[model samples]
Target: MHITLIVPTNGRPSLVSRLLAHLERQTLHPDHVIVSATTPNDIEVRPDISFKVSYVFGDPGLCAQRNRAMALCDGTTDIISFFDDDFVPCDSYLETLSRVFREHPVYAVVTGDLLADGAQGPGLGFDEAVAMLDAYRPSSLPAHVRDHPGAYGCNMSIRAQVIGDLRFDERLPLYGWQEDIDFTSQLRAHGRIVNIGQLWGVHLGAKGGRVNGVRLGYSQIVNPIYLIGKGTMQRWFGIRLICRNLVANTLKSLRPEPYIDRRGRLKGNMIGFAHVLTRRADPEHILKL
Candidate 1:
């Protein structure tokens, strides 16, 4: 099965380079690898690579960059995978995905497990990432493939034909919070979205080329609400997300975590909650806060 890999990045050249290095070791090489950046200078490519590599530039938004990469895929491409620039895939990542798609024709979307520091956080050196992958025992995971609610943007693949005309909702704006939910939820209507426990990768969760904590926090509150208004996310689900983040940020603010910017996020969450209380919360207003 021919595959096209799309990586949307901003200003993290080293991280992107590291991800590419991991892809080089994949047992199943992609027919093409597209690196879509916010600007031409956001990435640098090496002259030598086994597979075809293409670089494209667009406005600096995750959804926008991904849409641009999607447009660049060859017509013959069967599977199109999207991976974050900071994610490090296991050696057999593509091989596992290819096998799964070939075996399960009913699935429209497939996502894998993401490991980071024994938890779901990021930032692993190249050697460390490889070691973790070597140590992971897929046999221990449950054998059954189960239906998933939606695809995780960090490492997910979809049938190229299934996503023929669907594009991410640009209305979600920069960083495009919950854009995966908005996109994959629509894809669910076409076929099953499954989570393959055996297929796993590491999310480096590098703290760069990302928006400030305030903006992320604002989106955390507003994006879900926006999706609810758009009739994509259930109202209760959105409320649950808001409450969860607010409570987490509130608690963390009292005792900040090492990797998280708790204070900034808490301030932003409070601002968002205040806007909601005044009946003035809007996704567009998030930038102004």
Candidate 2:
């Protein structure tokens, strides 16, 4: 199977370059890699890489950049994989994915198990991520696959047949919070969305390039509601999501963590609630904040 790796990145040229170097070590190398970014400076050009690497430009939103990369996949590409710039996959990551897709024809989308995710807490360093990957024994664990409602954005792949004209919704904007779930969940109608344990990776979640706390917080509240209304997200799930974020932010703001802007996020959540109450909440409004 010809797999194309699409990495959508912004404001992290060096990080993306590091990810490319790691990809070179993949047991089953990708047929092509398309790095999508907002501007030329967002990525450093690499002329010495052995594998095929293509760079594309687009608007500054995550969904927009991903859409730009997806446009580059041609007929020869059998699978399209999306990886965040900070994610580090085990050496056999791509190889295992190829095997799974080749053996099972039922799955349309696949997401890997994350050994560690720094996005939930303080970001992890590149060296730390490499150490974690080095410690992992790919052959030690038994392969496991199970049905999933959605795919995580950091390390997910979709069969080309299922992606036929489908695209990430650009309305989410900026960080495109929950855009992964919105995109992969819809593919369930075409085939199964499953999690493959052998396709594991580490998410460094480096904080260098991230949306501001206010914008991100607004997204935490508004994006779920917007997606629910659009029929892309479950109503109960969306409501619980909003409530969880709101409660967490509100309580954490009292003794905010040094790494997070809890107060600002709380303020944004309040703003989102106000807008929602007035029936004027829009995911695009985060751009104005």
lDDT of 1: 0.82
- The lowest-lDDT stretch of 10 consecutive residues in candidate 1 is 115-124
What TM-score, computed on C-alpha atoms, does each candidate reach? 0.93, 0.97
Q: Where in model 1 is the C-alpha error above 4 Å?
A: 117-122, 140-142
Residue-wise C-alpha lDDT for candidate 2, range 1-289, written one tens digit per residue: 9999999999999999999988888988999999999899999887777889999997799999999998889999989999999999999989989998999899899999998999889989888988988987766667788887789999999999888898999999999999998999899998999998778888997888898889888999999999998888888888999999999999999999888888889888988989999999999999999
| Winning candidate number (lDDT) | 2
lDDT of 1 at 7: 95
Q: What's model 1's TM-score?
A: 0.93
User: Model 1 RMSD to the real structure?
Assistant: 2.0
